[model samples]
Target: MTRHGKNCTAGAVYTYHEKKKDTAASGYGTQNIRLSRDAVKDFDCCCLSLQPCHDPVVTPDGYLYEREAILEYILHQKKEIARQMQAYEKQRGARREEQKELQRAAAQDHVRGFLEKEAAIVSRPLNPFTPKAASAGNGPGAVTRDSLSNATPCAVLRPSGAVVTLECVEKLIRKDMVDPVTGEKLTDRDIIVLQRGGTGFAGSGVKLQAEKSRPVMQA
Candidate 1:
């Protein structure tokens, strides 16, 4: 046999060996299995009703409940608060009305008291204008200055067609020469001065002196 030939006779015989099934199983040990999204079930509500929740609301304590149920609870509490406020306002309004009624009654009482006092004053019998006593210094018919001061000075023209006294003439002059009682006219030259021992007759003399001193104006 040639050593360089294609099939060398000096080479050792070779045999093909197949892999064992137990060694292939031992190569891959126990694997860590992970579950998919389809395998896990959805979480449910933690409420006492145990009903299914569509829109979930998470509390601060990390507890989940139905949104509509919790909102209804909050609304009920708010309604209670509103009712309390309305009752309080009604009580306050009633108190204000009572105070106003009391004030009105007090005002009416004050007006009644004022009217009673005024009626008492009007019912008095004393005449304030009547003189108490006549003094000897003043004549029998003569009125004192104190008595005449508050009296309304009046003038009466006698039917004799003569102006009587200076005091009467002055009173007539103040009334535009028309007699206060008889409505008759009197002249300054016709006046007679009456001696009453008082300066009451001085007005007519002063008036005459003033007229004499005034320059006559020609028109």
Candidate 2:
């Protein structure tokens, strides 16, 4: 028995029935009959040793098997890493949403406080409801920087609503302790206008006629 490269064993002489007429006079007696042109020549030869074969059971250390195992391992690792990354990305997205909500809430609080003070100032009825009364005497209250010492995060009144910036507020109230506009003293009314527009009073200047009967103005 002649052993081929690796672990293959060459069996008795192989004979094809179609080629039998040509080799009939030859002394090499046939053992097994070849079925077809495509049939393997050696039955004892490990089929896994062929070029495109991938029978791990026949040749565990074949190139196909080793490479296949390595590729499979890499693919599995890629899937696992992708799953973990997906979970991490989800968690990170949730955290970002939470942070945005907190920022919005803080901004709203600053605006609310500013509006309340302005409302108190503008709500106060003058001695008379006439246009002259509105324009007379000391005139409307003006916002200054000194009054908003406790204010946090500067606020801007917009037609839609109030806008608050954390950095600006800290600078205005804590560091500079001044109003962005007027560049003068900060008053409680200024803080409110900063929070809500001056026109926001009486829900867009809707006066309460009954309040005129009161002896003293209520802010």
Candidate 3:
């Protein structure tokens, strides 16, 4: 019988009771991984595979993963993380470019407002007949300020990439936040603290504005 208790490096930690009646359904192997009502949520699941672990291994961050699945992830997923990050940065760069154009319009609006107020001082732009109002896209400050908005979800942790699920954040917070794929350790500095939205949702705590996402390991 599989033993149920806290995790250790030596043996399988079974969180749910089972009679070894598993079929080869999940494609991992023919191991009994059926979940029982007594199983604890999140506490008994694999971090990487998000499935019940037959051969559980605990990381330094105290997260559980299936031995074979995590080992495979550690070996091959490093490149996957890199690919994901490259794609994410590419998209973010494009968004920043768009934001710059929007910022130019905003700066023009500001200048228009200023001109309205200083009608007596200068009725027109300092061209041949008007003034040369600042270009919004030309200023570094404008680019910095306008690049970020509520529409942008913080992408500081690229390991999660577009898949910013709750499980993703959980793996990020505890311990040193190891990415099994890259064997990289992420600090809080790597995270872009999110601003609260109208929905009062952000990454202030573990609970993020991100949608829900998922499971286990043994001896």
Best by TM-score: 1
Q: Over the stretch 97-199, how does candidate 3's per-residue lDDT look in tens digits?
A: 9999999999999999998888857454221111123355321111122233344433334343221323345544445575433456766644444443533
lDDT of 3: 0.54
| Better candidate number, 1 or 3, judged by TM-score | 1
Q: How many clashing residue pairs are found in candidate 1?
A: 0
Report the Cα lDDT for residue 159, model 3: 46
- Model-by-model lDDT, in order? 0.53, 0.48, 0.54
Model 3 residue runs over 4 Å out of place are 1-71, 113-219
TM-score of each predicted structure versus truth? 0.29, 0.26, 0.23
Q: Sort by lDDT, best first: what order? A: 3, 1, 2
lDDT by residue for model 1 (1-219), tens? 465564634446442221244345567644444799755444675363456688888889876778888788789989999999999999999999999999999999999999999888855332122233447442121212333321233222332332233464554354586544356565653333333323446553223233346677999
Q: Name the lDDT value of residue 68 in candidate 2.
A: 55
Task: Name the Cα RMSD for model 1.
Answer: 35.8
lDDT of 2: 0.48
Winner on lDDT between 2 and 3 is 3
Tell me the alpha-carbon RMSD of every candidate. Answer: 35.8, 26.7, 37.1
Candidate 3, residue 25: Cα displacement in angstroms equals 21
lDDT, residue 155, model 2: 50
